[model samples]
Target: MEGCKRLEQLPKSIGSLSCLTNLNLSHCDRLANLQIHILEQPSPLESGLQRRKIIVHLPGEINKLSSLVNLSIDGRIHIQLLNLIGDAEHISCIPKQQTPDELLLSRCYVLKSLNIKRTRYNKDGSSFSCISFSDFHSLTELKLINLNILTIPDDIGQLQSLEKLDLSGNDFKSLPTSMTNLSRLKYARLSNCIKLVALPELTQLQTLKLSGCSNLRSLLNLSHAFHERVRYGLLELGLDNCRNFKSLSYQVRQLTSLIHLDLSRHDFEEIPESIRELSSLGTLCLNNCKKIKSVKDLPESLKHLYAHGCDSLENVSLSSNHSIEKLDLSHCFGMKQDEHLITQILNDGFSQVVCFLNNYSLVN
Candidate 1:
C-alpha cells in the first residue's frame, strides 16, 4: 500500500490478510469513497492481525470488518455497519445520522460503549421511532446529545452493565421504572431536560445531576441497597432550579459520603433538622430559596454555607462550637442583626469565618 497518498478505495484483497491485528489509516486527507462491504469482511491471511481491531477515519463504510472488535469512525456511517460486525465491542461514531435508535438497539448485545453527540434532527418529526434500545445488553456507557429526543426507551434498564449515562438537552418527561435495574450505574447527568418531572431509582448510583430541570417534583427513595451504597459512595448531588421539591433533609442525611450538596432555587421553608446529621458535609448551598425562613441546626463538619437571596429568612442561629468557617447570608430581607451572636463568633477566634452582616460591621 505504498504511493497510496490518496487511496480513493481500499483494496478488496486487503481482507485476505486475516492475520492483521491492528490497522491505522488516520489523517489520509485525500482518501475517500471507502466501500463499507470490503472493510466489513475478515482478511484471509489468518495472522494475528485478523483478530485485531480496526481504526478508520473514512466515512460510514466500515460495516465490512466482521472480525473487528473495536471500530472507530470519524464521520457519519451507514446503519448497516451494525449488522455486519459480529463481536464489535467498541464503536465511536461522529454524530451524523438523524436517529440511530434502530442501529443501536439491533446489535447492542455486543456493543459496550456508544457516544453520539451534536446530532441534529427535527423537534416534532417521525424520527423518534428510529431511536430504540431493546437489545442493549452489554452497554456500559451511553452518551447522547442534541438529538431532540422526547423520551427514552422504557427498556433502557436492560443494559445491566451500564455505568455512566448522559442524556442532556432532551425532552424526557420522566424516567422509566425499568431504570431501577441498572444496579451498576454510578454517574447520571440529565441537565437541561426541562420537561422531566421525576427521577428513576438508582440503587448503585453515586453521582447525579439534575440541573435546569424546572418541572421535576418528587424524588422517591430508592431500594435499601441503593440507599446503603449512596451512603458510602455518593459524593455529589445537584438539584438546581427544581422548584417543586419541598424537602430533601432526610435523603441528604443518608448520604454520609456526600461532601458537596446544592439545593438552590427550591421552596423549602427552613433547613431541615436532618441536615445536621450529615457529618461529612462541607459545602452546602441553599441560595435563591426565597421561601426559606431560617438556617438552624448547623452541622459540625460544615465549612461553607450559602443562603444568599433568601428573602424570607429572618433568623440564623449557629451552633456555639460549629466548625463553619464561611457564612454568606447576603440579601436576606428578614434577617435581624444580633450583636451578641456576632461577638460570640468573633471571640471564638475562628478567623476563617467570613460572615456577612446586616450592618456591614465586623463581629469584633
Candidate 2:
C-alpha cells in the first residue's frame, strides 16, 4: 500500500470475506479506514512504513474479527482489536510512532504471553500510561516494557499460569498484592523502574533482578518469598546498582537453595555465617565491599569467589575438599593464609584458580 495517497476507505463488504487470512496495508500514506473482520488466522501483517504512516480507523464492531488469533501490525495505526478478540493465545501489536492512551487487553481471555514493548527504547521518550488488563487469566508470560505505568491492577493476581513477568522501564511505585497469587512465577525483571519502591510476596519465585532501580529502599517481606521459594528449590538474586537499598529484613540462613547472589557496590560490612547453609551456592561476589573484615564458614559448594577490593578483609576460611574454582583477593591488604592450605586447594581443583589468585596473595 505504497503511494496510495488518495485512498480513503475500503469497501465495507471486505469484512464479509469469511476465508480472508492476510492483510498488508503497510506504508499506505492516505488509507484511513479498514472494515475487515479477518476470519482465518492472519499471518504477521507488518505495517512498518519508514516514510509515512498507514492510518486505519477501526469501526465499533465488537464481533468483527471473532476468529483472529494472530495479528501483527506496525506503524501508527489507531485500532482497537481487544473486545473483538476472544480466545487468542498470542498477540502482538506495535504502533512504533504514537503513544496511545490505553492498550486494551480485556478481550484476550486465553492469551498465554503478551508483549507490548517499544519498537525502540528511548530514555526520554513517551510511553502509554493507561491500559486495560483484564480477563487474561491464562497468561503465562507478560512483558510490557517502556509503558510508563504507575500501578499494576490488583487483578493481575488472576494469572495462575504465569511463569515470567518483565515490566522494565516503567513508572510503578508499588506492586499490587494481587501478584502474591502467581504461585508458578519463577522469573521477574524490573530493571530501570526509577520510581519503584516495593515488591509483593512471591511463593515460588526463583530469580529476581532489581538491577537499575534508584529509589527502591528495601525488598518488603522478602522473608516470605525466601521461605517459600527455598522450599520449592534453587533460586538466584541480583541487587546490582540499586543504590538506595539499605536493609534485608529476611533471614539469610534459611535460604539453603540459593545458588547465585550478587551484592556488589553496597555499604554492608559483615556477611553472617548463616550463609554457609547455602548448600547449592556457587557464585559469590563482594567486590568493592570496603568495610568487610572477615570471611569464614564458606560453603563447600562455592565455585567462584570475588572480593577484589575489600580493604579490611583479614581472614578467609577454606576447606581442603571444597569445589572452589577461582578466588579473587586482589587489593585485600589484610588477608593472611597459610601456604599449605593454598597447596591443598590447588591439588583438588584446577590450577587456574590457585595460580591466578596466588599472584595477589600478600607476602606475610
Candidate 3:
C-alpha cells in the first residue's frame, strides 16, 4: 500500500492475513487510521520456533504490531509526526527471499541509521519525547535536518556507538551537554543553524563543520585543556560564513592538529598570524575573503592554499621553507598591477608550485 496517496483507512477484516510478513504503507499522505491485527499462526515457510517479520513504513499508530522492529522515513512520506512504539527484543529474522534493502533493515535488531529531513509538524506543538535512544544500541549514524526542533533529549548521549551525526538546518539554540559523551563520534555537521548560539564541547570529533551558523559567537570552550596544549582529535574544521565570531586567532589556536581549515566568506583583513602555529596544517582555504588585503606568514607544512576571489589581495609572501605545491590566487586583481609580487611568488625556490592567477592558470 506504499504511495497510496488517497488511502484514508484500512479495512478491519485485513487482520485475517495470517501470512502477511511485509506491509509498506509509505507515501500514504491521507492514512489517518490503522486497523490491523497480529498474525499469530506461523507460516510453513519456517520451522517450529520461527516466526514471520513485518516491515511497516507506516503513518499511523502501530504499538500493537509487535513484529515491527524498524521504521524508515524517506522523501515519499508526507506524515506530520512519525510515532514509534514497539519493543526491540522480539526482532525477527528476515526472509531470505526479501530484497537486499529489506534484508539490510531487518538484519539489525533496531534502526541503525535514522534520517528525517524537511518534515512538517503540527501547528499546535511538536515533540520527539516518544523516541528513546537506549532502544537503538547499534545505531551508528543519525541525521535530523530542518525539523525545527528546539531541544534534543539529553539521552542522546546514550548512543555510544554513534559515529557520524549531522543536525544541520535545525532551530536548536544549544545542544545538550550530554552529547559530549558520544565517545566514538568522528564527524559532526551543524551547518546553517541560524539560531544556534552555542555548542557543547566536542573535543573527540575529527571533522566538525559549522558553516553559516551566524549566531554562534564562541567555541573557546571546545577544548577543556586549551591551556595545557592537549592535542585534540579534530583534523578538518570548517567555520566559513560564521561572521559573528568575535576572534579568529584564539578561536583556532588550540586546534593545532587541524590538517584542513576553511575560513572562507569572512570579513577579516588578514589571515591570523596565529595560524602559523598549526604546524600540521596542510590545506588552508581563504576563498572569497574580499576584505583580506594580503597573504603572508603561512605555515611551512601547508601544501595547498586557495585564496581566490580576494580582489583586495595585493601581496604574496612565502618563506623559503614553504612547501606549497598548489597556489590559487585567481581574481586577486590588486596583485596583477605589480609584476614583482607575482615574480616573487613564482621564485626559483618554489618551482614545484602550480599557481593559478587571474584569467589563466600556470604551472611552474
Best by lDDT: 3
Candidate 3 lDDT, tens digit per residue, 264-315?
Answer: 9999989987899999999999999999998899999999999989988878
Better of 1 and 3 by TM-score: 3
Best by TM-score: 3
Clashing pairs in 3: none
TM-score of each: 0.62, 0.63, 0.70
Candidate 1: RMSD to truth: 12.7
Cα lDDT, model 2, residue 327: 77
* Residue-wise C-alpha lDDT for candidate 2, range 1-364, written one tens digit per residue: 3334455555655544444433444434344444343323233437642322233433232222333234343433333344222212122632212112222333334455666565443556554543445655667788877656666777778778889999887888989888877888899989888888877655467888777787887664655554454344337877766668644525445456789877666566676556777889998887777878877678889889888778888767777667777778877776655566566665665655642242545221
TM-score of 3: 0.70
The lDDT per prediction is 0.63, 0.61, 0.69
Candidate 1 deviant stretches above 4 angstroms: 1-130, 133-141, 158-161, 221-233, 246-250, 253-257, 336-338, 358-364
Better of 1 and 2 by lDDT: 1
TM-score of 1: 0.62
- Write down the TM-score for model 2: 0.63
